[model samples]
Structure formats: structure tokens, C-alpha cells
Target chain A: MAVAESPPSDPEAPPKVRVGRTPGRLGNRVFQGISTASGIFILIILAAVAIFLLVRAWPALIAAPSAFEDVGFMLGRDLWSWVWPLLFGTAISSVIALVVAVPLSIGIGLFISHYAPRRLAQGLGYLIDLLAAIPSVIFGLWGIQWLQPLVSPLFTWLSTNGATAWLEENVGPTIFTGYQAPARNILTAGLVLAIMILPIITATVREVFLQTPRLHEEASLALGATRWEMIRQAVLPFGRSGVISATMLGLGRALGETMAVLMVLSPGYLINFYLLQPGQHQSIAANIASHFPEASGLGVDALIASGLILFIMTFGVNLIARWIISRRAEFSGAN
Target chain B: MSKRIDVNDLNVYYGDFLAVEGIDMVIEARSVTALIGPSGCGKSTFLRTLNRMHEVIPKAYVTGKAVMDGQDLYGPGVDPVEVRRQVGMVFQRPNPFPTMSIADNVLAGVRLNNRRISKSDAADLVERSLTGANLWNEVKDRLNLPGSSLSGGQQQRLCIARAIAVEPQVLLMDEPCSALDPISTLAIEELISELKNDYTIVIVTHNMQQAARVSDRTGFFNIAGTGKPGHLIEMDDTTTMFSTPSEKSTEDYISGRFG
Candidate 1:
């Protein structure tokens, strides 16, 4: 082997090598500062919104029944009495939407991620994402114009044939019973909300399902698990916390939805179990959106107070979702 | 309880492309058969074909025959699921079901099949399988912990325990210790040596020394070049293959010449 020649200047002295610093140091600092500012900006906006709502709603929050006498619907009702019904409506409608949507989304999500042909899966995924892009107001229009008339006969049949009467007789008339025609009821609003939120939940679920580690899936298959068994063993468990957070995302939308509930439901002011009956319930967002325009003085404050409640409900739900997700992480295989 | 495998003129394909061609070999029962090769030479693909796991990839298929005992694994009406039940596989990476506890992962093959086992039987199976895999002492107390909690080597052994919990006749390992540290590699190699007494084992490895240490018989697979189908170059007792390979290319490969 031939020896390489060395530089003549470094024969008797230590070599001097330039230690160059990383390039674009200022750009990196600016980028980090911008990202950190953007993150803090979200907190600032959230806090500002909360403060504004509380300031506007404070008067109505302390108002007596006489102060709300000018409020057309549910007149002379105190803040708690009036807000409780709206809160009940919000919770029930969102619950109903989730009950109907979660399983369907899981099925569709699994189909697109695992069962469908590759080409078809791509198309179905695109279609579901497109559904999410549709405006909520259009969903409201479709709910009232198309879905309401379509379900009227079925509602009429159930009411007339005593199909749901047994629920009243047995379980003391929980929200599951009391069918009515015209289909402009809380249940109809809920079904429409279910349809509206289905795409959001399904999209999240599909992405999570698609992200199931290929190695884990192959391991399950190598262990002799059938397609369904593999899904139960690998796919579902991997996506459990993901699905809960996805459902919560859907619930957040359903809880805060205004146009769909306002347009589909005949708003009422009492907490009741007659989900299939019109004029039986009203969610907070729909209540405010409907009355905010005509509301005057303290009535405007009351609507803002209701909006504050909706804000808190959404916040509470997200907190609960994070809690569940963190709890699941303790046992999750992903760690 | 273990089974020997007979492969006759097996050709593996991915879509229209032939990945491996003209493979003929017999794997004996109750022994470890190691397939050694360079990267992308189809040794791993051949390992997957043993359990019909190759078909899990879209458009991947195999032609010709792979038989275990008296049964044709690729015959019509032979469910791949059933084939997999009898011939379990471990990947190059450790992959225990993430959502499952150590005990549940050990029972996954059986429970995933929807077979019913009593609490006592399940406990017994977990203990026996873990003990067999040489992982019992480390994880016996944390059987309820998520399987991912184990170290890389222990996770690989947990995967081994999971594969054997179903009591498969054959266990195919594809570079089972490739991702592990030196100590973990030794642990898995020792486990493989002991496991061959009860189960027919086929392993694919890049490590020639590992093949020499743990395998009774060794087969060399090689590709002519890129886009060419990989073929089985030669097979012999591990001692003979490592010392004096019959094929020039096998000797060149073993002697650290160009792959």
C-alpha cells in the first residue's frame, strides 16, 4: 500500500481546522419563535373568548324570572330553570347522535382501511372526506326537506302500532320511545346530527385503522387469526383510544351544532323523554341561534350565557376524551 | 408433535414478477433448518411461504407445492388460516399485540381463533409457553403488563411464547434476533436450539455464524442479480456447508467475497 502525502505546514505543529457553526442559525431561531408564538396564540384566543362570554353573560346569569319575561319562548323562567332544559337537550341529542354514529363509522372505517379493494378503498375514503366538507346548513336543509318526510310514515307507524309504548310501560318512558309523525323532532334532529358527524368520526377512524402497524397485523395473521379475528385482536385494540377521541370529536360538533338542530327541531323548554315528539327539547346552540336575533337587552345576555354553557360543555368533553385516551395509553401496546 | 416440510419446485411471485424460483428442499421434523442469504434474496419470502403468510401481501403468490406431513398446504379447500394455525411464524422484528397483556399475548393465537379455554388452562398455557421460550423468569410476575413493556430481546421471546402457545407443529423464524443486541441474540439462539427438540423450525438469517451455531442443516439462497429470481443455491449439514460448501458462490459468500 502506498502512503499518502501530508501537508508541509503541519509537520511540526498541531493542525488548525476551522469549526464552522451550523448554517441558517437565525432562520432556525425565527422558525422556533414563530411556532411557539402560534401555539400560545391559540391559548390567548381561547381565554379571550371565555372572558368575553363571561362578561356578556354575567347579567343574565344572575337575572330573575321577571328579567326574562320579555323572552318569547319559555317566558318568566329563571336562568337555571331555562338553561337546564337546553343543557338536557344538548346532552341527549349528542348522546343519540353518538349512539347511532359510532358503530357505523367503525364498520365503514374498517371496511375502507382493510376490507375494500385498494382502488375502491381510495374512492370510498375520498367520498367520506367530501362528506365532511359539506356545509352544516345544507345538512339542515336536507334533514328537513328530504329526511323528515321520508321518516314520517315510519314514525307514524311506530306511534300508532304501540311499538314504542312498551318502553313507557317498562322503563318509564326514557328517550327511546314516544314516536310521532312530521319527523321534525329531537330524534330527527339527532339522526341528522348523526349523519353530519359520521364523516368526521369515520375519517379519523379510517386514518387510525390505516396506520395500524403492518408488523402487528402480520403477526396476528401468522398466528392463524381470520380477518375478523385479526381485526378484533390487532386493529380494534390498536385503534380503541383513537376511536374514543374520534367519537369525542364528533360529539363536539354535535353539541355545538346550530343550524341542523334549529331547523329540524321544534324547539321546547322542558326536559322530557319524548324524543320522537316535536316541541319537546331544544339544545343550547339552537336556542341561542333562534332567539338571538329577536332577543333584546337581558335576553341577549341570556343567549350569550347559554353560549358560555355550550363552550364549557365542549371543553369538558375534550378533557374527558384526553383523560380516557391517557388512561388507555397506560395499557396500550403502542408504548 | 412436530412436522417436517417438503417443498417441490416452489416459485414465489409478487404480482407478475417472479421473486423466487425453483426451490426444492426437505425440512426434517424436530430440527432447526436455517436459510442463509444476502438481502432481498427471497429467504424471508420462502420462510413466509411455509405458513402461507406470503399471501398476506397484496398480489403475492406461490406456485407448486409445500407439504407438511401428509397435507398439501396450498391445496384447494385448505384454509390459509388453518395452515397458519399449524405453522406459526415470527418476524425479524418483535411484534407482540400492543393492547394485550403478556399473558393475553401468549394466549392470542388460541383466543384469536375463538377457541374456549378455562382460566386454569390458559394460566397453564401461558406459564408453559413462557417457560419454553426462556422468558418465564423475567416476565412471570408482570404477565398482566402490556407486552410492549419488555426489552427488545424479551419482546422477541414473548413473541416466541405467543407463537408456541397455540402449539403449532412448525415454527418459522425470519431473522428472529436480527433486531436484538448481542446478548439477546445469544438468548434467542439458545432458545431456538432447545425449541427444535419439540418443534420443527425453519429460520432465515443474514448471519452465517448464527446458522452454524443453531441450525442442524443450512440452505443457501442467492439471486443472480437485480430483477432476477432468487433460487436455492445449495443445502447441506451446517458443519459441511460452513466448512466446505459445495457451490463456489456459497463459498465466496461465506468467505466474505462480493455478495
Candidate 2:
């Protein structure tokens, strides 16, 4: 009825309802469409990359001589070799990096956020962040030229007196049969990775720690708690999930790191537990980097297959980190 | 375990800035002393000094002495942590540890000190403290629930329970009922009266009616001008202070003439 009445009004009068000519309305819709398109575009690009990797990797697996001995298996070598050693090396080195980085990051984060005076904290925080800006190749070069020489004595001592002694005493000499202590090894590679990732974890965790409410800290102090006790009771509990996600972020970087591991570690095919020794393990990214230029025919497909695996591993680490963060959301009260 | 507090010529400062100056008062044992003042008059600052909580702020310092029982709280060898343990505090806003449960919140003061309690003893202490705060029946069945799940007034009472669980000689409250509704404010006022029988209570409040209703003695604090340090204007019995305050500023402040 209203529409019929409006049509009967004077023809010279402006229309009762405004059309799509309003700049504010048109601009808002256009901006919204752009944002939605950008989000969808990102998803499409990610999917395309995944599908491309999977399609390229399929030929290497299907061309294998046997089903059980193909690229499907993680432990064999006959043209389409298994990825067990690369996977093992990646896992162990990244795990070692996480073990070394997490505690040290938390300690540094706490010192910067809570313990240090304001000016010192600012200066220390800036210095730590500068570490993240250093190029990966530079870290690799430093690890090889300087870090290796410095750690050689410590590595020699460990091989003679540390876990090496216990392993030889209990498990026998079979394990160390082919082990050779080279200057570059998985341990050195992992140590370099740890230093590379420390800044990321420390920066993230320190921001989280700083976000802890002042009231909670004051409440803990007013309860007769010591400074350390107050931190444990309030700051640590509040930042627990943040710490987990920060460590996972560092782990993700360590897992896919190519150049630094390549420069520091002497690559080999077999997985060896003698981390202090050299010529033992080869991470997937480092292997792919070193082999990609010379690779031909199915060899390229094999490198892509290894790349696919590394991608999945890093993706899984990030997914788990997100899950842990969401699970802790209810208790964190950060909302 | 109540104790009298003797504050002599107290001066509080944050670095070069004096926050409050020349506060001398005798806070009797087993009674409530209400500090009533306008905002920025440093009533809360003076209350925090009683527990050494003011110095928690960076560069904050206090001079003079607060003698509790026979011990000087500001003595060179005295530990602030020990002073805090002896004199507990409830803040303007209820700040229950969001990560802790109701039971754990009550036990925080004891547990944070690294003093272990038997399971049965912990349960008993929780029940006793909750009962003292008048929050036992409402929360007893849901002791495992997070403390943040409670209403604003309930959270404040839970904080009170946590403070009293340590069995402090004195309890300092900085406008404990300011964030509550009228009914909750009345409930806390009643609780304060009951609490004074066991603990020497010092409360800072902007509410004159609350001061009149709950306190045995009332101290009025006022600032001279902007950027000037706050000072205590007068101290007297609650009845005298409300009806016939010695200072004109106290009379003006109490009667809503001016801050």
C-alpha cells in the first residue's frame, strides 16, 4: 500500500526511497566485498599450493617398484627412498631446539617484563628483538665459523665423559660403530636453531606476561607472597597458554629452517643418536635445498614429496598450538 | 589476634612528589576506624602504608613509623612481607585470582607463602574463613568453581575470606563496598561490624553514611589545593565527627558543601 501511494506522488519530486548513489553506503559495501574477496583469495592460494605439492609428489610414489617399499614408507632406499632419516633428523633437531629455547625464553621474558627496571627492560627488549632481524644465512655462517670452534671442546668433553660414557657402559659398542665426531653435527645445528628462535619466543611471551593485570600482581603481593611467589601465582598462570603458543611458533620455525641447518650440519642418510658426532642426519628442508638444483626426473618429485611432509608437520604444530590456546581460553579470562 | 596501630608523623612519597604528609593517629585494637575523604585526598594511600602496600608502586616510599603492638613496622630490619602477613588488605575492586577456584582463592595466602597444610586442615580453614565473610552457605556447595564466576559482591567477600584466612592482626580495606550494589553494600557493612570483634579494622571510604554506620572512630582527610599533598584535617568519634567536626573543611565535606 505504501509503495502504491508513493508512486502516485508528484513526478517532479525526488524519489521516496534513495537509490544506490549514496557514497557512504556504496563505499561500505565495496570495502566489505574487498575484505571478503581478500580472505577467500588467501584460502584459495593456500589450497592451490597444497594441491600443487600433492599432485607433484604423486608421480614419485606411483612410479616405485613395490607398494610397501615406495615413498609411502619412511624407512628404505631404492630410487624412491623413504624419508625416515630426514623426518627423524627434523624431529630431533626441532625438539632439541624447543627444549633449549622454551625455558630460556620464559626466563628472559620474565626478567624483561617483571624484574628489570624500566629503562633496562626497554633496552634489553630492543636488543633481543634485534636478534630476530638477523638473516638466517648470517646465523648459519656464524654457527659454522665461530660457534663450531667454541663448542668443539665442550663436545669432546661430552663424548668422553657425559651420556656417551653411560651409553657405552650400558648399551654396548654396537651403537657407536659408525659414529664419527665431526665439527658440524645435529647438536650444533640444533643449538644454532635455538638461538635463531629465542627472540621470537621471548618477544611473544614477554608481551603476554606484560598483559597480566596489575591488580592480580598486587593481590598476590598483599597476600604476603614473595616476588617469585607472586610471579608463580599470578603472572605464570596468566601467561601459560601464551607460553605454549610461543614455543610452538619457535618450533615451527626450527622444523622448516633450511639454510642454517644446511650450513651447520654435515648431511648423511642414516639417523644417528650420537648428536655430538658429525655426518649423522639430514633435515628435510636442508636436504631439499642441497639436492633441488641437481635433481632430475623423479628426483624433483621426491624433493617435493619431502617438502609436502615438512609442510604438513609445521601445519600440524600450528594447529595443535591453536587448539591448546582455545582450550585455555576459558581459564585465562583474557576475554 | 587484634593489635593497636600507632602511626606517628607519617609522610608518603612517590619519588620527589609527596603524596600524603604528617599523619598522626592512634588506631585502637579490635575496632573500626574509617577514613573519609574526597578523591585524590590520599586516604587510600595512607591505608596502604599501614600494610606497606604503598611501596609496591615504583619509587614509592614512606617515612615515620607505624607501630603495631610493640613492634615498629618501619624498623630497618623489619620485612615488608612479614608486615603484609600481619596486616591484610582488601582493595577497592575485588581481585580474585581468575585462574583459582573458590577453595584455592581462600587458601592462596597460606599456599603462596609455601606453608603446607594437611587436607583436612585446609578444608576446615576454607570453611571457617568463608563463614567469617558470611559467604559460606551460598558458596559452600560450589567450592571447586572458579572465583571469577561469582557476582561482584561475592567476589569482594571471597577476597575478604582470603585475607582473613591468614589470621592477620589487622585488616585494611580500601573502599571495599564501593563497587557493590546497595544491598551488597549493606551486607558488607554488617560484615565489617562483625569483623571488628576479631581484627583491628581500618577502612577508607568516600561514603559518609557508610563511615557513620560502621566505624567507631572517623578521620577526615583533605587536600589544600591541586598538586598539594593530602593531610588529615581532624579525627574524632564517629558521632562527634558527623555532628560537630572541629574543622570547617570537615564540616563542609561531610555536609556536601564542597570537597
DockQ values per model: 0.84, 0.63
Query: In model 1, which regions exceed 4 Å deviation?
Result: A1-22, A162-178
lDDT of 2 by residue, A222-296 (tens): 999999999999999999888998998899899989999999998877776768667778899998998888777
Best by TM-score: 1
List TM-score per model, in order.
Answer: 0.96, 0.92
Runs of candidate 2 with Cα error greater than 4 angstroms are A1-31, A65-81, A162-167, A171-181
The whole-model C-alpha lDDT of candidate 1 against the native structure comes to 0.91
Model 2 chain A poorest 10 in a row by lDDT: A67-76
> How displaced is residue A162 in candidate 2, in Å?
7.0
- The global C-alpha lDDT for each of the candidates, from Candidate 1 onward, is 0.91, 0.90
Local accuracy of candidate 1 as per-residue lDDT tens digits, A1-335: 87756666767754577366667988999999999999999999999999999999999887776777777765778788889999999999999999999999999999999999999999999999999999999999999999999988877766655545766676676554656677889889999999999999999999999989999999999999999998998999999988998999999999999999999998888788787888889999999888888888888898899899999989988998888889868676568
Q: Is the docking of candidate 1 incorrect, acceptable, medium or high quality?
A: high
In model 2, pairs of residues that clash are none
